[model samples]
Target: MRNAWSRAMVRGAWLLASILGSSAGFCEQMNLREFGQPDGLGNLALNALQQDAQGFLWAGTENGLYRHDGQRIERVATQELRRVAALASGGGHLWILSDTGTWWWHDGRLERVLPRTAKLPQDVPMAIAARGDEAWFVTVGGLQHVVVDRQTDSWSSSPVMTAEQLARHPEMGRLASVMLARDGALWAGCGDAICRWHRGELKRWDARSGVARQQWHALLEASDGSVWARSTQATLQLSAGAEGFVDRTAPSDRGDPMHRYPLVEDAAHRILTASQLGVLRWQGQQWQSFGKRQGLPGDGRVHALLSDREGGLWLGLRGTGLLQWRGYGRWESWTDADGLPSSVVWTMQRDGEGRGALHVGTGRGLAAFDAAQGVFRQVPLPHAGDLFGLVPDGQGGLWAATDVATFHHVRDGRGLPGPITTPGGTEDGFLWALASKDGALWVITAGKLHRWPEAGRGPVQAVPGPPGNAQEHFYDACETPDGTLWLAGARGLARRRAGQWLSSLAVEDGVTYVACGEDGTVVAASEAGQAWRVRTPGAAKPSLESLDAPVLKGRMIVSLLIDSRGWLWLGTDAGLVVHDGTHWKLLDRSQGLAWNDTSGHALYEDGDRSMWIGTSRGLSRLIDPSQVFATALPRPVLMSATR
Candidate 1:
């Protein structure tokens, strides 16, 4: 069964990709969040940033060095080592260069490279690069190399290029930036040229070698094994076996030749940098700009940039503090401040036919999104109350349920007088959930379950639920493609097949949500975050298996959805967790979610496959969720172990 599910997921992912296409407008925009003194960084003028082996981010500022572990920032070094210049991490140690001198941090202890009694040259260090037990520093005077004796906690320093070598190649002096490439070669940006040191041979490139003579201030080895050099004048790239570098500067940067932008390569091997205009990404042999028009916060100049292991882009603004861009998808949010009826969104459904407007149910009332104006307009309903359980009718209308009543044929901001009635034609109380499949609508009111036939041609039939507590309330329900109906609520899970209700499947905690997969499988989740998968849902002897995901162990799951791509999305009290068969990833406020606590029955997939999450603060739309599945997973290798 697991193999069959995996095959379905791969097929669905490919189909989804082809359907989405490669339109320019389909690309995700940059989603950025800024952090400042409020987020625990004492200083805003960041000088350098690096990610260590353990995945912690190190930020250097004028005051001190701080460490960030995705949540909070704490000062790790004293204030005496002021004006940190550069940082590099490798071999389980972080090398630091500051105005005072050079230092290395290991196992929470910081030690100066040289004691105050034996100080080295007083020239300011421009950049630092590390590999294994060796670190290199580029300074105004020359390039310095340091080797560490880890066992003895001692180190030795020497000049990489001696004065004789500098005299032979005059253009290699005045080094500014350095990078240790994956090929074990040391690349440096000299004042008037770029140099590569491999083994004992040192090669230089200057105007004579068809390269620009501007001072290169930054160097990076991209994922494609190409070396990129950045200067205030232009940016250049050197391909694997290329003799010289090619000027790949953006056309816009050619006009302003003095803008110094920080450069970093993202997890996707795309070159990323930022100017006063906004963030720029190198794609299709050109620079694509994402500026204030694309929802970037504060127009301050970006000073330091680093791409973390999780694919997030970090920008250290000159004075605006730190900012992180969520790399998966662009998030467009709306709240009361953005013309939403209320900040507390309960449910959402797409209205009309193809690519229709989204109708949302908020704490105050209902509102429809006007994509053209990029704002939500209040759609007044007959009963002014909080709404939930919104599902689309077969026609260009909707079926919505509030606490006191349920309405059908809800169109153009007005609903018809249609409510769920009992067998005696009396109104039911407190409608809780609604589901539609094969033109048949399933309604759960308080504790009673009813089936409303297609187009309301026949009378509503009150169905008998699985035997359990008389007052057991139903919270959610879904119907598989095989005409199997699954219901989840306080008591647990129940299924109905061929008009016959089966016995109740009791879980540890009462199941609160249920979702149907395209392969006739049903996934049910309890409030305690325990989830179970039922295969062959239409069969009399269906098999049940528990989903083992440590990330969802103690989370309070409020909503569950199995998207067309076979990805399971869980809306929980902490955040939104998605499992793509082999891996689980969390998308919270840190990743551009409006809020961590998602609302019940608030997870919806639009006609375009985008996800809409309704939170207490507002609503967020995750554009192009298929991007997360773009990268292929590595195949596993098995090994036999002997006891």
Candidate 2:
């Protein structure tokens, strides 16, 4: 606080708003500069969202195919199965299988045509399943097939298998269902028998061996991906390797009447057995019946059920509001009482962690959840959470720079361990927060760019920058993992690399911060939010906004931070956003961000996936995630980035 250099830092922070007063002010007048989805891909009905191994969301909607990377949704416009029926993925790319052929979303690019032909099986994929290197899908033609050779990646009109092979297994001729078991084997639930195809061979097992008088109804493979099936008279569990079946519904295992439509398996030990009379959960040893006796949708016949991200089960009663199980013997109804979209939830998607949210986007804007408690709430921002720059802190935390402020949080629901403070207070601000090579926290406050040894084990320290004229004046500062500092203010942008303050980026190869990878490039953005390196400042990279004034009017880019995943998060005046290597994604209210636009003021990471986004209004954290929903599938709604 006694440093003369720190005094200069406080006086130089006003240069940004003053510069914005020109172009940004003009756009603000016209109200043309909005931050979110101002144009394209209007509220696309995102029915299916899955995350591939690479962490990108492959969305299959009622309309077309989109690739969402948590910030922006990319339309596979060319020939990506419009009105896409079923979506399944494996080996890194998304398989957009329609009624005719497959469109491969592979290698960060879309191949409009994988292969489709009328001469081959009818392509309307009912349900697609996959194992390690292989995948199997059932077409409306009643046939189960695999992705035989993606390396060679060739196919033909003729059957992938021989006619003799098909003749030998007439039971598998009409494929009804399929599932990829936990052990990486593909299970084909045909009308007669369920065959296992994996490791270059196909094997068959029929239901007659278990349910003598019944046929297979449904199949569910859980997180472990173990395969389980239910028939009219029995519930069978597939052997780990899928060599045979274990029928649990014998007279000993409870010879209950078999369920007709829904058969959900929990890992492999339990099965949700639904019958016209009632519903029961069959663990390895017992059948726990739940119905009017247990407050499960007053009706004895439970038709449909949806579980939220919070482990609360929801039952879709034939004639009642959606029901929720609060705790032991406690039921909360979401009829007209709460903000439920409808009493009749034909289908629901429990997302964000099964702890919150049940997206039922029917006729309204989009109704589901508003995360309440927990340090890391998965609620939507009022409108924007688009991502921009990220610096993954390796310890399960990330640093995000939004259009608003810096943001950092763990993806899981766990809250921060303690109070987050920079080396100093808010006076050295506007853009004065960053991390150091040894995980030190550097911030500009009062009269100096303060440096706090991030762990607190060391003494609180201060790093002084250029002085300014007024007490209200201050500068912006960001640190890198390598001890470099990037600071900006009324004067200009400056960085410290080799123990010296370089007035420009060129001294450090035009990098804002010390980066450990090829992605360490600093962007000097101003003038309609146009960006280039500070060195160039006018070369084109990608447009954060196409319109100039709309952003100035309402939504301004408030913060920017980076995550370990190499993506950029932007906290904008409108909301929050993220930028993957390729696209711009707006992460605001609709996608479960905080209600306030000031959510990310000072961001930091914990070296893991944990991110802490500090807003002027409140503090928010995204804890380390427990469950990762799949975007490589055609299911319903958001992922790392919500729709």
Tell me, by lDDT, which candidate is best: 1
RMSD of each: 9.3, 17.2
* TM-score between candidate 2 and the true structure: 0.37
lDDT of 2 at 523: 41
Global lDDT scores for all candidate models: 0.68, 0.41
Residue 124, candidate 1: C-alpha displacement in angstroms: 8.5
| Model 1 weakest 10-residue run by lDDT | 6-15
TM-score on alpha carbons, each prediction: 0.63, 0.37
**lDDT of predicted model 2:** 0.41
lDDT (tens digit, per residue) of candidate 2 on 60-79: 54556655554565666645
lDDT of 1: 0.68
**lDDT tens digits, residue span 1-643, model 1:** 1111111000000001212222112222345677788879988878788888767788888778888776688888774577786789988889988878779898888888744443332222237889989998765566678898978978888877778877876555667677888888888876678898887688888887757877677788888878888887678888878898888777655433444566788766789776667666777466766666455666746668887655567887667777777533346555666566777777776656424556767777777655444445777666556665566677877776565545545675566666443442135444344555567777676567777776445777767666555566676788888777788876677877677777677775677678988877688887677888886666666766889989997887777889888889988778889888888888887667777777765677766777877777777777668865567333211000000
What would the TM-score be for candidate 1 when compared with the true structure? Answer: 0.63
